[model samples]
Target: MYSKFLILLLLSAFCTSCGSKPETTRPVTGTITESVYASGVIKGENQYQVYSTVNGLVEKVLVSEGDLVKKGTPVIQLVGKVAMLNTENAGLAAAYSRISANGERLSELENNISLARQKMNNDASLFERQKNLWDQKIGTRLEYEQRELAYSNAVNAFETAKLRYNEALKQLRFQEQQSQKNLQILQTSAKDYIIKSESEGQVYDILKKAGEMVTPQTAIAIIGDASRFLIELQIDEYDIAKIKIGQKILVNMDSYRGTTFEAKVSRVIPYMNERSKSFTIEAVFVKAPQTLYPNLTCEANIVISHKEKALTIPRDYLLDGGYVLLQKEKKQKVSTGLMDYQRVEILGGLKGDENLIKPQ
Candidate 1:
């Protein structure tokens, strides 16, 4: 009888302890997402380093660092003494004058050709009259031969005159071409003295100072459009597969304390860094702050996957190996697809109406 009473007490204690475990709440309907958190730096899209295209002394620096500039604005002025001197000493003026003189000479050649044509016509009339007299047997053949020789000489002179006229036209064309080419060189020299901006942007740096001798390809200034900015982040090798273009992102910059901005993934670089074993990704802000600056450090959360209006449970309920104890009754094994830092996506094995529990 004593042994039976001990067994009954132990059984009752075991049942009471089983009933004492607390109940856990399951999420009913909300969006569940998988995300990755990372750090990044802000940069502009239109950043470029400006360089000079001609060798000269920097006569003036019209823009200082941090000055806003527009397209075609003169950022620097250079004086090319050799180039200017060459232009002044060259035969450009003489070439233009020669082209004008060639035009007048071509007109004179045309007049000479007209006079040769008139002489040829008169000689041909005389030769035809002498031919008619010889055919009628009333004039000597020598007279006809002399008139024919005169006509032939007239024809030769006319042909020579036409050839000279055509030659003069060709010379005129050649002179025009030479003059135009020279004028173009002079125009280029005038424009080369001024260094113009290629785009509308802010001047971020000035590499050359006034009176500095700069050659073609020497960096003059750094300019970029500051209005557009993006965050460049590196994803670890383990988490790179979870990032994709067009993913929604939450960004927080260290400069904007306690504030966050919405952004979207714009690019995912295909290649990975061999040394760091990471891949780079870029995100563009949906609502950018007015005070954003380049190289600003930012933290980003990349949302990889999502579930809409589905059942979810607190992440703490997951046990070792992603198993969960449900209502302290059954061990539910779930297949996960995506997860945030706290919550994970349940792919299968859990019914929408099942109960969940938190492990102590």
Candidate 2:
């Protein structure tokens, strides 16, 4: 009978221990932060791909990857035999068409004009002398008429010579101007064969080799500012509305593992990326890493709001639809506020001293 009583006692104890005894904890006063998550890459300021304006075989690459360059620096030289020949031909044409080159021809025209004027003056004198002789009754009528006709012919010849000289001078000037303009254009075009950097920066990549063919459409190199860098992030569409310029951002980069960097949003691209279904935004580093390079992958969290002291509980303890389990398996609804990955803010229905049961 004592053994039976002992066995009953053990069974009762086992059943009692197995009965539901839920774990519980009270809410604590702490800080809570709400933020949006993003992921993107690092880009140097003013980064851009370099392209040549004309088509040619690359004869030499003047700048290598990681070379520092100034604005208007020569980056590549192209094989421009045809361009050189065209320029030379244009120069020769310009030289031959110069007004000074036709000095001898103009001199001949001037000489003819002078001769015509002298003959015209001589004819006028003879005609006057003949008229005087006829008036004095010492010359025949035929002689007077002949002298008048000769004077008229000499005047016409003089005018014709002057007209021819003026026309020749005008033609020469026009040709000179036209040829000079053509030479200037060809000279500018020849300079296009030497590709130059458009901005002051460092060359990050040289995309083409010395023997590769390049056209205006081909990018020959990549360049950007050497010292300045920015973070480019794509924020999901659901959280895009929370993003704003000047918001604080916490950045983590793969290159700098375990280190968090602070940055601020500088720009928000107003357009959405159709493929990614995300909005693109840019941020400038406030506390930058010692060394940074272009195209570094990074993850970021943009802080939207924060509270230093709030009644908060672990996210797992809170049930869906804003309810929490209390003692005796009772459910009570709670008004919530700002939340993060691990915690949720309880604004109402739960005091800091109440024990909340973990839901099974």
Candidate 3:
């Protein structure tokens, strides 16, 4: 009986000692760096859908997929009646000068005027000499009359030649203006025969094949420099307030396994979509990989609120808002502050050394 009594006494002492010692629990401490995580898909900085501005049958494709193209580079050629008509009209107008040459015609008119003036000068000389003789009574009236008549005929011929030269100048100017107008029309028509790139980029897709009929609004090929990447994430409405612009973020891509990337919140859109009950958030990577492709799936974490030295407790220990069983003895209500998904801030009713915790 004494041995049994001693054993009971020893066990009692051990129990008392164990109860007096501080209990081991899961540590609940304030987090210095708060974070929120989300998953989304990677996208390009700019996307383009190329289309044709003129309607025709696709004749030729100058670029294939992955080909680098410059602004205003020809992408495709359209074959149709309109293209043929433009080529024919330009040829006809360019060759129109062959039928009637204005410069040659002008030269001919000038030569005729020169001959007429020479005849007028010769006749005048004869008429002057006769007039002088008539004044001196040394020439007969019939001879003077014949010379004057000849001079009058030469003057009429010279006047007619001058009029013809002026008409030729007018015709030459009119023909030059007409030719320029026709040339402009032909140039405009030629532009419709080919589609050109509006931006410098890589051809990502070819929507139309050669010999396919297309319209002005037809999307032919997509060309864009999709090298740089960004992420578009949809955040829930309940968590929108915790997110802000310029917040630091962490990213993980499905393609890059066991590798993580960093990014920042560039924009936090204010409006929430009714269908999604979420807001769109955009982020840019800090150091993007060269192999990052567009439409790649990615996850993001946006750090929100952080605390370092404040009182905190495990989330599972609390019975309700601001309520917890202290040291397995008494229940007390307390005020709280900032909360995370794992822990809650204990603002009042608990000391740092006080035992108010539970098992993990």
Question: Pick by lDDT: which candidate is best?
Answer: 2
Candidate 3: give the clashing pairs.
Answer: none
lDDT of 1 by residue, 294-325 (tens): 67888988877777855566777778887878
TM-scores for all candidates: the values are 0.67, 0.77, 0.56
lDDT of each: 0.81, 0.94, 0.78
Which is better, 1 or 3, measured by lDDT? 1
Q: Which has the better TM-score: candidate 2, or candidate 3?
A: 2
Residue 292 in candidate 1, Cα distance off native in Å: 2.5
- Per-residue CA lDDT of candidate 2, range 1-360, in tens? 999999999999999989958889899999999999999999989989999989999999998889999999999999988888999999999999988999999999999999999999999999999999999999799999999999999999999999999999999999999999999998989999999999999999999998999999989999999999999999999999999899999999989999999999999999998998999999999989999999999999999999999999999999989999888879999999999999999999987788899998
Q: Which stretches of candidate 2 lie above 4 Å from their native place?
A: 1-29, 128-149, 236-241, 269-279, 310-360
* lDDT for residue 279 in candidate 3, whole number 0-100: 88
After superposition of all CA atoms, the RMSD between model 3 and the true structure is: 11.8
- Best of the two (1, 2) by TM-score: 2
Worst 10 residues of 3 by lDDT: 21-30
Compose the digit string of candidate 3's lDDT tens values, residues 1-360: 999999999999999987885433433555644567687877766657777767788889888987888899988888857666766776676556432555677778889999999999999999999999999998799999999999999999999999989976776667666776777777777786788888887787788899898787778887777476778888988888888888888888879989888898988878899998988898998888768666688887787867787777767777665677766557868787766677777778766566665533
